[model samples]
Target chain A: MKLSRALGASVFAAILMTGGCDTVWHPSIPPVAGPAEFPTGQIARGAELAAIGDCSVCHTTEGSRPYASGRGVQTPFGVVYATNITPDPETGIGTWPESAFRRAMREGVDRDGRNLYPVFPYPHFTRATDRDIAALYAFLMTRPAVHADTPPNRLPFPLNQRFVLTGWDHLYLRPGAWQPDPAHDADWNRGAYLVEAVGHCGGCHTPRNVLGAETDGQALAGGEAENWYAPPLQAASPARQGWSVDSLTAYLRTGFDAGHGAAAGPMTAVTAELATVPAADVRAMAVYLTSMMPKPAPAPVVAHAGEDPVFAGACGGCHGPDAPMMRNGAPSLAMSTAVNAPTPRGTIQAILQGLPWREGQAAPYMPPFASVLTDAQIAELAAYLRSAYSDKPAWRDLPAEVARVRGAS
Target chain B: MIRLTVNGQQHEVDAEADTPLLYVLRDDLGLNGAKFGCGLGQCGACTVLVDGQPVFSCLTPVSVLAERQVRTIEGLGGNAVQRAFEDVQAAQCGYCIAGMVMRATALLEHNPHPHEDEIRAYMSGNLCRCGTHMRILEAVRQAAGQGVKP
Candidate 1:
């Protein structure tokens, strides 16, 4: 009787442990059926749509087999490996039902009722239509199964626990398909959906808060990732290359922007896959991106007399009564390209680094006063320069400008 | 272990047979010009001359390079491509120049002078994100005696 009781206890303990293991080990959610069955054509369309989504970028290893996962994407908290989407029974999405896939893609939930971390970008995928989502499921279902089991994510202790994401989702996630604005043209609406939804271009291009959520109001207003700046997609963008629609299309397709900057870092991935997309879609994206321009405010001119004590005391020694003509290679404030550039970033850089004296050039060059000047003083100087020459408003905050400059440098 | 000849010089290195020739060049021989862009052989930033043909170094494993004479951007035609690069100001950040030059050099060696469509098709595999394609195209044309008339 004692031996039988002990055996029963051992069996119960094994079952409990196995169940717990299953809960943690299985990354996928239980499969759920779609609202309606997809046709064969829809599945094929989904394969193409998957390409539009650029699904291979995040999921595939850099040099290994395509879509077999094991790519480690770094986050603020930790690194997460993209799971296999191939139809491997043990390792990939072979067993995931269509509903589970939809839920994971749209709601950021996993099989087994656990909330998936937002790093998968389901927040943006939530905008995908039901038809499109079903198609994507069909396409994924058809891909050859590769039995590569990716290692578990290495997140910080509390963050490693999946429950925390429930709160995060509550605050940020809005689960639903994209609803077209009835007022807009089909092309415009299509462009908006493509840019905002499947493309998820903003995920990397937009500035984010400390929590890694995008600052919604400043959408596509530039961000920093992997030590490179993803420049703003607004009209105020100082395009190194001119921003014509045709040029933009070519740049998007080829990853070169003619006279503008090349895509680097994460953008390389974007261009490689994105460039291969339809030309019309590329043009639409350009149109939508170019349309977003922050309205220009009227310039405020602050008149400062030559005799103003503040200006006379601080700047007279170098600039003189009439801002001295840039001569002998000392960039005259009057003719300085650094000062005249459309954006003040170049001028700020010059001020911070100081004008270096060319060989056999003038000696009284602009000195590096960055160490000596307080943030306020620098702001005043910049304000004085802009007012005295160009009629542009001073950047609101000097410290932030300084930080951006320092970070870029 | 694989035996390879680079710029007509023979060498032997031990690595995973599947290791990309770009890694072999960068990690083994310390040639850094061929950058690692998208490592799936998508972007041609890792272009190098494989027996006088432009090939993506990232996808060409060292094992496949056994007994093959390889040429990098560094060893092309007395750096004629580099001169052309300077003449047209065909570099911005210069990260893509090496690959661009390698590809262009291969084009010139094969065709001497290629049409715009031909150039575009041939160079499509290589990406220049800086938007210097016009200047680069102009430079290639100039090298071919097509001049800057177009």
Candidate 2:
């Protein structure tokens, strides 16, 4: 989702600059003089929505105060620093009224009526109900007010102009809350709202147009994040095993399933956040996401004795036939989503940046090979894995792909 | 039978192609310098040098080390790094000391004089449960100053 989000934002800039539409402006709401009071129940509900939204992952830096917001979100155009949403009177959104927050969520405008960038993902947030927005505002306002100034975004000339967002929003922004789908049951509708609005899964999963807006019909057809490929969740999913609602819930809630490996890269943080929300909500999401996928065909498992020294050495510890991890029921590489992915980017990335070791937590952990293996070595190993484990065709231009990913890292 | 060089001696060991070099070193060859802590490579207790690069021997299979040079703490007997560790008394309970020394040896071999930050990052893989890190860092610094043969 990282790369696609960047490309989407860059496309937004192009649309904004070229559209040459009217520069729409709204009168700024005078700063609320004091802290506004919200009900306890509303604050609690808002907390759930924020977790589902994964607000902290982007808005907070590692080991810093949450929502203090100096984290640099990467985009194709440049870096957009997540703004401080804490209730700090000086640097955060302490002065903003609920109306201002609603407008920002609905119209992609700030309290000052300045056009906020699309990197904030208002395109998805626009579909959220008014009650949810109020709840989010309450939750944000009640936070331990942290005072930290966000750095200026690093966009080139025309893209740097916030005014350009006005035109981009005109072209892409579909305002108003999501209406319940009459055909689908309440559970499905709830899942759809969470996925489209708060979860904003499409912000990363959905492929974007040249102008950076997500392609209308192709909702969860795979996309890119940072450098790793986010595999499709729809009919084109590369999953060798079919996803059931229960399995999807387990994967999203805990970041691992016996059939599929742990979530790596950007999705790791996502699953971590999802773990905090209600399991029922996650199950609902699983229900909706699984409905889109057709029954998976039995994955062809090939048995080629891997000859690559790197795989035998670096990977055999966990993945080899007699390895303890495999012996203890870890899934085979044949079941790996990345190995079956149409692109080699996911596999290459997993090798270079292995699953991290969480302290005191027992999970699937692999040491990073970015330092351990050379780019050429990584390419050779990736190819060896694909041929050995799956019946998929050998990935093309693997050396170039490895080089590109390593260079980006 | 997999043939590989260990501590300047070539040996043929009876093991599977995917058998971890750690088991071969400890179980077959009886060279126990590399411990089998968390056979999952997260702990660097099984660290050894493969072609001068540090790797978790528990994770590295003999199949990959066909003709490669594998050096263990047994090979570094009283070498500069060992001497430095001894001089600083950088061991507590001493379970993880061997792995720490091997990883530090590799780091020095690659970058003889690394910055404090670089040393911390390089040594992150090796876990020292005894918490004798301050002394271990001193030993590495001492070893870097004395300079050892590659």
Q: Could you say which candidate leads in lDDT?
A: 2
Compared with the true structure, the alpha-carbon lDDT of candidate 1 equals: 0.66
Q: What is the DockQ of each candidate?
A: 0.02, 0.36
- Candidate 2 chain A: worst 10 consecutive residues by lDDT? A1-10
Give the true-contact fraction for every prediction, in order: 0.00, 0.44
Off by over 4 Å in 1: A1-40, A240-242, A294-409, B1-150
Give the CAPRI rating of model 2.
Answer: acceptable
* Model 2 Cα lDDT, one tens digit per residue, A1-409: 4554664466566566656545566679888878889999999989999999999988998756999999887766679999999998789999998899998998889899888888788999999999999999999999999989999998776667777677677678888779889999888889989999989999889887765678888888998878788989888988888888988899999889878778998898888888888998999999889889867456456686735666776787688788898888788888899998899998999998898775556666778766556677788889888888777799999999999999886
Off by over 4 Å in 2: A1-21, A24-26, A296-309, B1-35, B48-54, B61-90, B101-124, B131-150
TM-scores of the candidates are: 0.50, 0.84
Over the stretch B101-125, how does candidate 1's per-residue lDDT look in tens digits?
A: 8888878777876888788767766
lDDT of each: 0.66, 0.85
